[model samples]
Target chain A: MMNPKGTQPEDLVWECQACHVNLVEGPVTLMYMGNRITVDLPQCPRCGFVLVSEAVALGKMAEVEQALEDK
Target chain B: MTAFTARALSHVPHVLRGITGNTLRPGGLALTERAADWCAFQPGARVLDIGCGLGATLMYLRDIRGCRACGLAISAQMLSECRGMPVLQAAGDILPFYDKCLDGIFCECVVSLLVEPPKAFREFCRVLRPAGWLVLTDVYLRNPQSGAGDLAASATCLSGASDNTELMKHLNDCGFDVILWEDHSRYLTELAARMVWTLGSRELLMQLLFPGGCSAENKQNMQGASPGYGLWIARLKGPKR
Candidate 1:
């Protein structure tokens, strides 16, 4: 599996827990602040499962929301 | 930096400027102007701004203080937005400048986000001329353990934040003398509140921006995190050896 930018191995390992397939990095659409934004993330190539690391889920995402809302 | 985190940090200045006007940091241009005043740059003095964001403070220094200012930012998007301003794509920890060349440095709200803050401090000392002033403002953890184990909070510049003691230690260890330290946590809290009010519903806004990121429990933890913000003015020790 290719490593995503800004993600360290300890931060996240791209493998689907259910499908047991190594995740590949790609752009995936997710709902943010009621808007659909496409962001790069690790996902299972076979099962389409996106992996959200704890840092990305809480840290970056929350900051993005706050910044957008401030606008 | 991860693509998402980079995008988020790059987007913050543009978004906040739209709402809060020119100054992107917590206390606005007033605080920035005050910091510039503290730096006390002489006419034609050369200065650098670390993590310059949108170059607002650089402009202020040039136009208001008669200083020749350049900025360093990691975000290409931000540098492009600067539109001919003397901003380079660079990180604070590895400044691309000759030793003891700059007259002063102005860094706001950027320290907490640094991956290697101690290294950055050392770099700051290296770049500044002897007795050059360094003005900085950033968030710090009021209670070190308040956000322990919260990966998200760490990402938001809330985790790994040092209190006054640690900051002073870094400055002194880096061969800088503290000139001033001011608590501005109230202003930061006010800014946060203003952002929430502008969005109408904080929870709703979070849901939209980071679905599955902001749970009720996480929000509660953040509320109780006891974060604080501060501004510091220091000077590099004289006669670089």
Candidate 2:
């Protein structure tokens, strides 16, 4: 129920291009197949645009999605 | 008794205890109620719940459904939690009961985890009355060939999951007539999805299940098995004795 390692592998600070704000790791709720999970991920503080890094998009996120689908 | 569930009880029994305190296993007590309905035991009939963790289902059967229900749990911790309840500490393979003493037996998510399922079923046959019902709900394999043999006990339910054919063979060989077999696989996928979210990832779930991290072979074996949850209501075959 706690936040997992969701940021990209690199420790580089990501700045939102549109909001011109630094993305901070905050609570992000992801839903798939009628199941929801809240985890901390990088997001713009002002606009609340969540940044799901490529590593997370391909790694933990994808893995959980596959497991849910059972494919 | 070398049950995966017993081992898990030693590690993360608290988490499972949380679930069992409410509704253990897939489809929850709704499935239990369904099994009870299908079994159709008369009121005040003596019944036994095998591996009755937390004694929730045992309470339900006795209090709600009006049966004289007692339970047998393998875990000492679980048994300790049921202080005032009519529960006994015993293993499924070696139930300490007289022959033909009970009208029904209810076991959920316990048999497959056993080191020897047929042995326990044989025990069930020996103890159950000729007209007794055996209500079982557990995971089974969709792909008959896809499974881990010796290493099955390493994972959770997937470890002991054999295909429906093998299960049917076990039931038939143990002298039971299959009354019903219904697949409730969506419950498993839904629960797995919820678990994935709650634990953050499949790997975290695996880690929670297998503390200190599981081996590649164990993980691969778990992932390789195509498991499906099922409910079976069977009757011990013989004229009432």
Candidate 3:
């Protein structure tokens, strides 16, 4: 199957260590401050282990925290 | 910064209702439920929802809460979406009702958008029965001294926010005594963050939501404004004195 639009893997790919399989792009739901927001991220299809990339961690995650703090 | 066209931000609820859980404002109907619970509105109570974007609260009030709720919206486009719901097209400052007719008014996320807040307060006072409750959820200016004139021409709620002292005075002068004040700033911040994440950046979110225009500088101007959200529950004492 082809990756969905805008779900291309980042420069650094991640493999699930336990499942011994490469991560595939899929939907992930993030819960924060009693709210749930869904986004696309890399995860192991076999074991469903998600990978949080450095770019996403520092980029959108930072934005979410900045939004939550309000300070 | 590119300027927002007239009433651009005010139209946010209509454009983004799909992603915002079919409600026009932050915290959606969850905030509405909280406010109604706080007011202890009985079944069959007559309530008005000012700025009722798509009349989600109207359905909730009538079907779930068992209240005789009517909604008012300044935008005809907003009212057009309310199929088979009890709602009206009108401004908050000029409500269409006899004196002391309503049991409560849900002015959620709308007070700060009023062009003439004092006038709207008087209208809220005039339309409510004695001790009739008002539930207000709105964005507020966090830093009163800074960004004083930056949003002079913007149509967002940030343009109309005032310091707490001034806000309380407005309520008092309109014969309302506040029964509860709760800080819900997280809701506003969370919504902003979600928009930023979904749209890639705050600028992009602004551009999409307000098609007129937005620039990087407007983002800075917004940060300078330091917006916050709050919920206020008050009861009308009598006619404005």
Candidate 4:
């Protein structure tokens, strides 16, 4: 239950943006893939949307933040 | 010589998983839930729980992930214990499923019980789809020498522990790419102590259930006691086709 220190790879619980179902399981490692795009090797369990890798998810915080702000 | 069947101890996990969540004996529900939640099961994912004793973890998965879940076990008695739930009788060494059938596969404290862990890992690999996730929590070796005494010991509830290196090797050879592997030794060691002490206090009852001296004291007195166990997450490699 410890919060991640900004640069640390945070173990997060995310929902599918399209379906709103929680993506509660899988390994998401944080890596720099040039501007940080979340690479979901495994797709969403319900909708088959590619679930992003942990690294990508952590790296793409700005995009996720923007998307969240937009919503 | 005493033999233990999965059915005989089926209710143990049923009651324990409800209490502990992770099904590794008497750990608190918080640790158990944290273990289960750590798998990060995707919503509506196809998950197969091998040796889904008592269906407790499966229940957790169903409730949390809303995923389609199925189970396989060798003990009809244990399978019966899971009655009215989505479970099938099968063994870990040879799971009764087709290739790439599951997105996530989980096992709890049951791997070391397998007579052939390599075969079991192969079976796990066979059933998982490419990049499919695997979540496992079982006993491991903290100090390599601690496992030596049990190698030749007769089968008991705790008879099937594998060292950390062997476990990792089997998973890797079976085509799984390791992700997160943790040495939950302190937890297992603590459980081993508590398991012996608490179960010893209930020797008469366990004798009634097992009938042939599978009590906590008997297991504790044995030379091959393990102090460390592990939890691992790996991915099945993509299909050849």
Per-residue lDDT of model 1, residues B1-241, tens digit only = 4221221262553334555565666777777787877776777999998888778888888888888999988878777877777888877888889998999988888887776677888889898988899998888766655652353443344544566788889899888999999888755655554454344446644543344476666565555556678989999987655
Q: Write the per-residue lDDT of candidate 3 for residues B154-189, one digit (tens) a residue.
A: 556666766666787899888899989888876776
| lDDT-better candidate, 2 vs 4 | 2
Off by over 4 Å in 2: A1-64, B1-8, B17-20, B149-155, B212-221, B239-241
Candidate 2 differs from the real structure by a C-alpha RMSD in angstroms, to one decimal, of 6.7
Docking class of 3: acceptable
Better of 1 and 2 by DockQ: 2
TM-score of each: 0.69, 0.74, 0.80, 0.60
Better of 1 and 3 by DockQ: 3
B16-85, model 2: which lDDT tens digit per residue?
4343344557666888988888877667999999888877788889888899999988777777776677
Give the Cα-based TM-score of candidate 3 against the true structure.
0.80
Mind giving the per-residue lDDT tens digits that candidate 3 earns over A1-65? Answer: 22666664475567899998989888888877665666778899999999887667877776766
**iRMS (Å) per candidate:** 11.7, 3.8, 3.2, 23.1
Q: Measured with DockQ on alpha carbons, how good is candidate 3?
A: 0.33
What TM-score would chain A of each candidate receive against the reference chain A?
0.70, 0.80, 0.74, 0.36
* Residue B192, model 1: Cα distance from true site in angstroms: 1.0
DockQ score, prediction 4: 0.01
